[model samples]
Target: REQADLQRVFPDLYMNSLSNVLTQGMNRKKKHEVEALAAVVSWIARSVGANTVVDVGAGQGYLAQVLSFEYQLSVIAIDACSHHGRITNARAERIKKHYAAKMHKSRSEDRNLNMPKTVTCRVLSTDTFKTLSDSLLQKDDLQKANLTGKGVGEHSLEGLPDGNVPSCCVDSKPSLLLAGLHACGDLSVTMLRTFLECKDVKAVVSIGCCYNLLSEEVENADSQCGFPMSKGIKSAGLSLGKSSRDLACQSAERWRCLGKDAGLHNFELHAFRAAFQMVLFRYYPEILITSPAIGRQGKALRRQHHQRILESTLHHEESAHSSPSLSQKNCKKKGSCPTMNSAEAGTAKNKGTFEIPLSDTGNSTPKSCGAADFASSILEMDALFRGVSFNQSTKCEATKSVDKYSLFEKFSRSGLCRLGLHHLQDINFAGLWKETEPFAELIGPYWSLRAALGPVLETILLLDRLLFLQEQGNSLEAVMIPIFDPTLSPRNVALIAKKI
Candidate 1:
């Protein structure tokens, strides 16, 4: 059956919701996400008679803000990042002021119109669920007031600055719906576990992201991972490696963008990376190692492809060992060396070919290799790999250079693999270029295909969590539900469960 048919068959199960007044100032994507999430949580909250909500990984508290102000449900927005909490509090306060002014204007305009009670939002910068008992422990009204000194329902001074306590700390509010909007990786699993462990959390709504960041339970096949949490799934010996999990996170929306005609320019970088990887392996066969990936550095290299590599002005202890002769010509007595940026690179386009020199047959001592030769090797790799042809005139510039041989060799031995060499088998120029050309052509479709399987893979992962929740007891109703638009928000599926 079609998706529409599935929606028709299980309308309530899907937990569809419409955006409301709370979404007024937010962006379109965020507004839609907050609206859908809040509506579903409100429905679940009403079903379970939960007036309080504990939002885990509530960065900026978008859902929490909506639940508290629009739905009139008291919410505790919890995040580990203090910066995020501060921003959330500031935004909430600004919105509250705007809404208050709007309400006052409405009341003066028409006395007949009903005025809703003013709502407040509080942000707590701590992992609230980590110490559940400490936060949730009950105390006498007088004792609680003294312990907190704040009014009952007002923010408490528990583990947060300026008298901010989690909603769970409000002793009078025992029942709460635990919710997380795209709580990343292990945190999503943590939310589900907390729901089962804590009796006060009446229900849970979890939308997870960053599957690749999940911690594995068992190191090998014998060990259990965070995913496949259900006993049956674990018993079946199922596992998704970090690579597979990353594939599951590829965005279909990005693939659609790449499918457009304008996306043709994007292919050049991929082809260049592929060619560069071949070059790395051809000269340094040991560089094909993949365990310690060049992750963020590789991405930076790709994004800033046009940046020219100035001779090593900055030296790390590790890189310093490779070469000691620092160039004085390019290096003035005091100032820093000039590096390439977008504007500079745009004006001076270099398209000349870079030739890799063959190793000397004679036993030439490491000291004999001059800085110019090392600089040539470094520029050759950096220029071609980064998709920028180096200005041959600048090649002769006496710039401080590191011994590329010892540097990359030691790097390879230490398991630091170059990017784009992950599945690269052949290092031949003609063959690699030919494979890269077709590979570039197929990237759009290949990316889309991987993205297409995302929801299916995500469903499997969610079902595993839900099944684990159900296995805890028969008194639970747990299932994966579509809560947001998939195209607009790739992490649109949510795992919602209530203790029946």
Candidate 2:
């Protein structure tokens, strides 16, 4: 899809109308989304004659604020996270002041901003939407104009107070338009279901992320699964296991954009993480069942790795300044001396092929790794063995025996310490690296090819959503449009539908 698709479809009423004040706190990527989406949805609300636009999963109220203040349309900002609701309210106040100043409106005149009503409630099922419809419609809205700031509410759907009314308080029946930006997993699917079930909900414009987190019926028959929302897939028994769903979120463009050094570093990190599963399997077998995910230990390892280099550099500079170092003098005479480069040192190993022995043959032979299978297995292993608490570590002999695994030893020890594995006194990380290191060079090429398949999964999932809307009967119109730059926002397509 072209980046200009959004701009082309809606020419006269579009992104350019946004100001710096409106776009504050948004980065380039977010700014692009808000500007493009706000314009299109604004035009949609107008075209469809929707009085109130309800933004489901409205984090920080960026889109809601734009619709309420700029477009002068009433809006409801609903989010499950209470903190997001709190933040959205705070952000709304700031934008109100900006708009007031821009338009030269008095406190009494500020009612024209039509500040979005903040609702902090979970949209778990269609039942929530039914309750929301009742709560909003049942309120007395004649005094909404007079209430203004007083009417801006953080009300729950269970009940509304006489003193508190909604900012989008309607005198007549409401035309509810549902929306979500990066609504997580089941929440996005929940919105589509709501749109279909609730008569009051006339339209829905949704963009979702976190496919990995989406509930699957195959995983658990009890919980409602977000996948296979379309009847066609449900009948076909198509289930993308969480491992593959996580892979669906990968970006081909992001990988392509990486420079050689950065890319290779990432590949090494992946190999180390895969090897981490071996550590878990050997020392803490039971922990795999528990699936204890200590947050971002890989990222922690990366941070620690960089910190060591920085500290070493500082110590070397200080030593050079304090005294006439022979190494420094020799380095000046013979150009800059290089630090140990693992890739260069392992040139011989990289060329060697790795293989898993076949059970019947009882012979070892070189085997080419299938990129998809390798990525899937590695991802599943990481997911299974994650959050390992290897709190205790034995002194690694591998780092001293062979310099290749010095960094790997650090990574493994850090991982072991996190998993609290103390009894592994003779864990030979070098042997494990020796066993698996031959496959390290193959990771970059294999993973790159695997990453390309991400969109195929994404497309099928999106198609399922589209088919769901279509199968609901011809009374509703549905379309999935490529609205934003896919490179900037990988989940760029918006699922939009309007009931006839």
Candidate 3:
């Protein structure tokens, strides 16, 4: 993917759409996207002279409801998830009641609002999608639609020529214009293919997301892949490696807008995750290869980590009183033992380090004693293991500062135990984190750069799709437009095509 394509695409290729999301049960960000996309779908429907709008991957049917009730376009909302269809229908009923109440408030003579028909179907292929699209337009579906005033199948689409009528559609005229908001991977490409293949589907408005799920032709040519759709790309034999494809979905703009402290906090999380991976690699190599996913231990354990750190720091007195043998009173007051008071305990707590002064006595605390020294009162293992130095601290400046390695180790055990690896023995998590901790600081800058590079990958993909549509013929008018604020919706660009 060329970086220049980004400049080329942004300045000229995408049409900017503006609107507010008014649908219920949606967050502010989702509302912005839905409203903008619904507006575009309405415009395309009017331009293409299509009476019906088929919203594929309708999710909970936010866009579908808007296009139907707000824009007054006949709609058929389809999703692979059966539960989504049920939710959409339920929500649609609520919306319909709201509309009815509004008309009553105005005291206007109003007819019933037509609800978008819900269809739960996994659209796998062009033929499969075509069958679903065609069947819903037949006389049987039309009779069903008559129950509501001029619903999806019963829409008047008289002007479409014989070429636009499918073999299955005898007398029914469902001039459908397809619309998809964040259609995942192959489903988006499948809609485009279906639009070209099915006669009744005269136009398409699609916005795709989840680039990571896209299959590559290079991986297996037999599989109907989504990437490199254009002859331009296929001719070049280009492939977006799976890792880079995953990067394409990262929203640099969203990350860039994050507050300074928030951004650094997120970066620290990435560090913890990286070190945890190192733990798996060192201790459970076979399990790491077998079940690669540890499932976001950094995120799940963060609250617990912070609580433990706070408690260990603030509750030093509680731990200090527990073991009388390791108590400061047990040591020669003027000996190598460091004194602890409210101030010293507070300092140690904030520093998140457990420190014990090294002694000249042959029975001196080992260099590693500092690793978990705050808990020396609790463990009291020093008396039992005389020669075996259980708490050896590595002599490193970075390790001397704040012992995040211990915090990371704490996180690692929780993660490992979550995966039922508690029975494994002799796993040195502190040592594992120490080896990789130096690279942790680089994560913030590296992530920023990766986020910046994401849009380039996304641009190349959209360009390939646009070029593919153009490669079809001049009879098709196609475009990739910015339909939502990128800050609100990272996958904001929509791929739209209409028969000219």
Models 1 onward score TM values of 0.59, 0.72, 0.70
Model 3, residue pairs in steric clash: 313-349, 367-393, 368-391, 368-392, 368-393, 369-391
lDDT of 1 by residue, 99-181 (tens): 67777877753422211111122322124453442353443222332234232232333534433433345546567688888
- Clash number by candidate, in order: 2, 13, 6
- The worst-scoring run of ten residues by lDDT in candidate 1 lies at 112-121
Which ranges of candidate 3 are over 4 A from the true structure? Answer: 1-22, 139-167, 219-223, 295-403, 417-425
Residue by residue across 1-500, what tens digits does model 2's lDDT show? 44556655656665556788878899888888987788878877776777678898898899998888777878888887778878888888988888778677544553566788887777778776656655565343423323223234676543444434334434666787888888898899988988888777888889988999887775343345688787777877788988788888888766776645446667776787777777777767898678755345545434444444446446556756787465355344311221212322122122343221111111111122344333322332232122111111312122222233544554565454455444366677778888888887888888887788888888888898999899989899998888888778878889989988
- Per lDDT, the best of the predicted structures is 2
Candidate 3 lands at a TM-score of 0.70
Cα lDDT, model 3, residue 369: 26
Report clash pairs, candidate 1. 218-223, 218-224
Whole-model lDDT for model 2 versus the true structure?
0.66
Error of 3 at 263 (Å): 1.9
- On a 0 to 100 scale, what is the lDDT of residue 254 in model 3? 79
Off by over 4 Å in 2: 105-111, 138-152, 158-171, 218-224, 294-404, 413-426
